[model samples]
Target chain A: MARPSDTKTRIQAVARELFMEQGVQNTSLKQISDRLGITKPALYYHFESREALVRSILQPLLDDLDTFTATLAPGDARRLLEDCFELMWRHREVLVMLLHDPGTMLGLDLVERVWEWRKRLTALLLGPSPSAAARIHATVAIGGMSDCVVEHASLPFEEVRAAAVAAALAALQS
Target chain B: MARPSDTKTRIQAVARELFMEQGVQNTSLKQISDRLGITKPALYYHFESREALVRSILQPLLDDLDTFTATLAPGDARRLLEDCFELMWRHREVLVMLLHDPGTMLGLDLVERVWEWRKRLTALLLGPSPSAAARIHATVAIGGMSDCVVEHASLPFEEVRAAAVAAALAALQS
Candidate 1:
């Protein structure tokens, strides 16, 4: 679905492949260029630095979530949470990488982005005057979704998804 | 409760404090010794390196969990699960540190220890032949407790604990 003129899109896809295969720390810009069959200068033309490139990759994902969150109907809370989690699960690798190495400058920037999104979404879900129990529920429900997939990777995808939904629903009721 | 010949205990307390404060990568053996008001040579008498010291610190925690798991009634599963979670909550700092930076050799070793505990506990909780739904419930119940404290640290301790317990009980019923 991504267009060819979108060099940023191409670079992100290639970089994500490399990150998933060899880890973000181990993968290099030159290697990413080589794999993309582009010169170093061409890659540099699109992204000034590796960190910048990573940010570009992450921005759209967060923006998509933001847009999704913006469109949620206040009445359909359960569905809204489910869709948000589905989107996160769809991008599990990025979430997992950001969480594990949150110490790196780029990683921290990405985590801040995630945290901001989390704060916004948490506020929307629990509202400003949530009960202590609702606050706890909202926290666990949001945190557990990504964490379940990250820690329970050996299990089948369906099972992980089911557990996350169950956990979220249980938290909401509590 | 800490005794003088408790060389192991002293070393663990010092290492944990240093690691949590300055991170595992930044903390040094010399600093640990200096803070503990012991000579580097004296610290070396107990632990060969920082990695070894971290392992020593983790040993007792693992031993305690192992003993706890071994004594679980297996019949009174709900109480046993609650007790396990209470222990995890009581030692929350160690869990938070490990989760924050799981890339350290120390972190990897501790993760392996915890995973082994998870494996045994999961088997006891779900046996070998649990249905998919049952497995999901079991996984969420086990994971929800730690998630409550680790992810929901901003909430008051009692609020998080109560919500976590409520969530776990709901998951059991679901």
Candidate 2:
């Protein structure tokens, strides 16, 4: 006897568990509903499609990213990289789900959103009248931080997060 | 009038041009043939599908990657980074085509190959008894270099290359 308000959260949880287990590409909405003991229609009522479901699942991370980018100010590269890495590390599961089947990511509109977000982050990191090479360094710094956590998920969080931030700062300095 | 052997090369070149000028997703095989003033069947004789055509166009880059990775030796990070940066620079067009329509990159089998290649490279870069943080640093170092050139293509080759190599060395030292 689940309440209506909690049903959406429940669905998001089950969908992520299933996506992580069998991969995003292989898991169907029907499978998710079946596991939750709800009808497929019930699932569709909450999420129109897999894209919508993935988006809803990742909305919090996107919101955090949007919030950080909105409040972004000129700062030392290390401080900025630390905040960005923490934001992503907080959403580690989303990155894990994506690492399982990355192709599924491109299908979601979030890719475009993240790309735009990266551009904004890049611009912020670029600072005043930066050289062309400096811009590349800043972009590389940003892109690499997000990627390392996913690629080395088996690594200790504290260890990898620090490493990613260090690497980003290194790129930014270059 | 291309010779039968060179038709493949010509198709690959025109396909890349159309893919770059338009986009990999938007440009059709017919458009490539239309631009080349050749019949669809004639084009088909060279490439059965857009996937095959993209593979053909990027084969040289992939082959170079394979060659370098195959002959990978235990070397200083700067030397390894320089070789990798140069290889990517030489195949700049392929990266440009991909950056234009990144979503299309997932549709090709090359994505899987590239992922696997990344794993192999990460392993090679991870020196003996590496810490989890060290592993993350190495992988970040490797990924950032490839992405920087593509993301900041307008940057001078010498400058970006130097920055990327320097950034990579900084990461490796971490």
Candidate 3:
């Protein structure tokens, strides 16, 4: 039998897996509970709604971005940008979720968080006196790196990762 | 009085504007008709449903990608890619519409056309025997360009276009 903490983690994991496979709208608490061999009541003990479940699922991802961003020194621009790309590549599922489900209120809130992260990233990438074009370039480059892995769905995972990193680094240089 | 064709064109233009401004889900055919100073029946003469109106708006954009892709010669790989970016930049609003409200059946159909265009483009960018990693890089670089322009609401139009073009060209080269 799973411990209380273990059960809570399992629900999140199952919820995320279902969300990814079937989309956020289609996945219900009952479905998640069914998949986990837990009662629907058991699932609700951890999350009252799918929105709460999504937020819980994404909290760690947001925290990771925060932690990574906070660790960068002011002038460590290149590494900071690279780290951002690395984090995005590593957390491709979170991004896929963002792209596929940007319409929901939850999705919009997540997008706002993403936007804030991008602004901080842009400041870090272009230390001072970024022209309108340079700033746009930095933002697009970072944005591209975050979402590129999903489109390369046919390629082997490692190949996709390597290519994404290289292209992201190149975008940084330009 | 506008000619019949001119009236049709005006409705489309206004609908596209409203879609961009208010989003597809929020905009209604009645609103579109009223904004164009036409009766509901008149709007229906040109478009039977909101879905039809959206398709009419998107068809030209899809046709543009078709026309653009058809012009690419084997030796003009780089030019072809740049032209594609320019087309996307030029039709930024339509691209944003597709990105934001990727609706039900018809929306997916239009998106599939764009995907096909991208596949054709992927073929052109990478000559025979390009590595899997190269293909992924190409997808990131190219896909990122358009995706960035649409998502980065803060970036100015020309800067986004220029950065997308430059980043794509650099990725193609490297």
Candidate 4:
């Protein structure tokens, strides 16, 4: 029999493909199971629900983000911008899912989860206490990149990456 | 007796108040009715559900957005930014509502609605056929403003207004 870890990796791979094609809201467990050539029970044993599966897929990205932001200082704006775009672009589809509503309402406190992450990133970029305007610029700088990444998802990777990083820096400097 | 229109207006006001204070997902129709000293059925008589009521509250803002975007050209970024901020800030609570998931998942197609508006706004800013980078910058510029407004919700309105506008312009220019 295939290892349980192998089965788990296959599930994540198939689920990400289906989700990227049809959106997180539209994909179902049955679809994932069918595509994986596994039964519903097997899928259930792996993931409690679609939300659980989604969180599993996303947790690593969040961890990488946490690692990157953990030691970031205010002067690291360009590095932060470039690194964030790289991290986000790698998981652009999931980033799009989080940016939208149905995927966020997937019962895992995805909303609060993302918001807290944003707050942490914002504080890291602006320091402990930022002025209202400084706060807004940082907010805009970081918040602006995801949707731009989504909108330009079809463009060449390097093209989208450059634009998003440059635009984020401009927002910070503004 | 208070007029029917007055009751509808009062319901909208109270619902908005409750939604802004807590959040759309947490605010129930019953709570809105109780706050207005009306029955739930009376509330239902005017609107079908929380989603319907939210639609009623946000429609004008969308309408105004459509109106403003309806007549514009490229190089209209400044006027567009200023006018859009005015419209959005006045309805900032509802803006937060749409930005959020629970409020959006209230059975409204708000995700689609706002997305269509964004496409139109992006098109106007970048012309009908902007390059890939131009598209991303336009997406970043306009998309950048809403969260900045939300973050600085407490500061004097003018400060947020100036900062948001400047940040948006910087994004576009970048």
Candidate 5:
């Protein structure tokens, strides 16, 4: 048997693949267990419910975003924005899932959390007392980065990353 | 009794309003007819089905986009982009409906048409045989304008229009 920690990681990987392929609504715990070659009881030993499994899969990405946001300082916005584009590119599948099916796959509460995190991130990027134009600029910048990552997922990573960062910076500075 | 043309226009306006307020799936034909103070037969006379109504609402936007794209010249990319943003802003309610409930509300054919329109728009912006980076830049520029229009629909139109156009131009130039 895989070690407990290794088993948890494996479960998350399998679940993410299944969710992306067939959608979170169509995927079930049984399918995940069957793919993992584990029994239902074994799957239940780790995750109490499908929602719990989803939370487990998503928590790490959220934590990474939180850590990145927590490290923001003055004058670091441009570099940090680039880093953010890279991070989002690394996790593009999850981002696509969240964007494509927020209501059915993730539910309203989690969607609200993602929106709140984005609002905070935007505020941090723009700094204190930003004008309305500045706020709109930041919002558009982030939106541009997200669309680039999701829409051009098949492109070479380095090229897409560089282009998205450039576009985002231009939106911010304009 | 209202004129046939007047009734059709009234149904479209009321349906758009209700769809934005309570989502497309939640709003039924009966509710729409009730709000318009029309009988079911009158509503059915104007629109054979809800899908037909949705198509009617979207076809004009697509026609407008088609007309705009047909008029583009070599040096008109920037001006055309600004005009595209204005068009998107004017029809943002429909855009929001398509974004929020894409699968159930708009159906696959309509969504495919929207996607096709966007691809055509991107091609026009980037020109033929563009580099991957240029394509990404164009995608991001359009995405920025879309996000600005959809997310800040409550903001004054001129402010959002000016900010989105400026940001889109910067994204393209960068």
Candidate 6:
């Protein structure tokens, strides 16, 4: 038998795959368990519910973002923006699910967390008291990053990353 | 009693308002008729169904976008981008509904239409054979405009418009 941590990781991986393929609303614990050849009870042992599963999958990303933000100094706008783009690109599927399916995030506090993160990232990019134009620029730059990365799924990752980072910096500076 | 055309216009207006306020799925034809102080039959006469009403609301915007795109000359990337931003701003509430409530668009062909429009706009901005980098840049620039304008609901429209346009141009050029 797989270790408990390995099983949990496997479950999360399967759940993300199912969620991406069929949407979070349509995918169920039963489906996830069935795919893994595990009983529902075993799945439940790791994740009490679907919401818990989503939380488990997202918490790491959020925590990583928090850590990334903490590591940033006041004037690291370009590097910070690039890192943000990279983070979103790495988790493009989850971000796409959140962007395209509002129902996936209905009961979760993920949306608010993301909003707060965006605000913090914007402040980081433009300083604490950015002008209205600067604020808009930051907002647009990030939006562009997510949209480009998610939409161009078949593209080479490095090219997409570089283009997205460059585009975001241009938007921010403009 | 209002003229038939006026009644249809009023029904469309009220439906858009209710859809924006309570989401498209939550808003019913009866509720729309009731708010407009018209009988259900009268409302149905104007719009055969809720789906039809949504199509009516979206069709004009799509048509306007088509017209706007056709007006763009080969090198009018900056102007095309600005007009696209303006079109989205004009329908900001509807855009917000589409962005936040995925259910609002279920069974409707709005999403595909929007995707096609985005591709056409990107092609217009970047030319027929844009490099992968240019494509990503265009994608991000447009994403930024929509995110900034929609998220900053209370910001002055002119400021947002100018910033989004400038940012989009910068992203495209970069």
Could you say which candidate leads in DockQ? 6
lDDT digits (tens) for residues B9-53 of candidate 4: 899999888766655655688899999998899998888876689
Between candidates 4 and 6, the one scoring higher on DockQ is: 6
Ranking by DockQ: 6, 5, 3, 4, 1, 2
Error of 3 at A22 (Å): 7.0
Ranked by TM-score from best down, the candidates are 6, 3, 5, 4, 2, 1
TM-score of decoy 2: 0.74
For model 6, residues B1-174, the per-residue Cα lDDT tens digits are 555578888888888887766566556778988998988888777667767788888777667766765665556777787778888988787787677556555576666667777878888787789888988888888888898768876888888888889998999999
TM-scores of the models, in the given order? 0.73, 0.74, 0.77, 0.76, 0.76, 0.80
Return the interface RMSD of the candidates, in order shown, one decimal each. 3.2, 4.8, 2.9, 3.6, 2.3, 2.2
The candidate scoring highest on TM-score is 6
Question: Please, what is the whole-model Cα lDDT of each candidate in the order they appear?
Answer: 0.68, 0.75, 0.69, 0.75, 0.77, 0.79
- Determine which window of 10 residues in candidate 6 chain B has minimal summed lDDT: B100-109
Best of the two (1, 5) by TM-score: 5
Tens-digit lDDT string for candidate 6 (A1-174): 555568889999999898776566557789999999998999878878778888887776777667765665666777787778778877788876666556555576666767767777777777779888888888888888888877888898888888888988988888
What residue pairs are clashing in model 4?
none
Give candidate 5's error at residue A107 in angstroms: 5.0
Better of 1 and 6 by DockQ: 6
Query: What lDDT would candidate 2 get against the real structure?
Result: 0.75
- The CAPRI class of candidate 5 is acceptable
The docking category that best describes candidate 6 is medium
Query: What does candidate 1's lDDT look like per residue over B1-174, in tens digits?
Result: 546558667877888987765455556788988888887888878778767777665566677767775776565566656776777887777766555455553344555667777777767777787776666666667666776777666766666777777766666556
Candidate 1 collision pairs:
none
Local error of candidate 4 at A145, Å? 1.3
Local distance difference test, candidate 1: 0.68
* Ranking 3 against 4 by DockQ, winner: 3
Q: Indicate the TM-score of model 5.
A: 0.76
Give DockQ for candidates 1 onward, in order: 0.34, 0.33, 0.42, 0.41, 0.46, 0.56
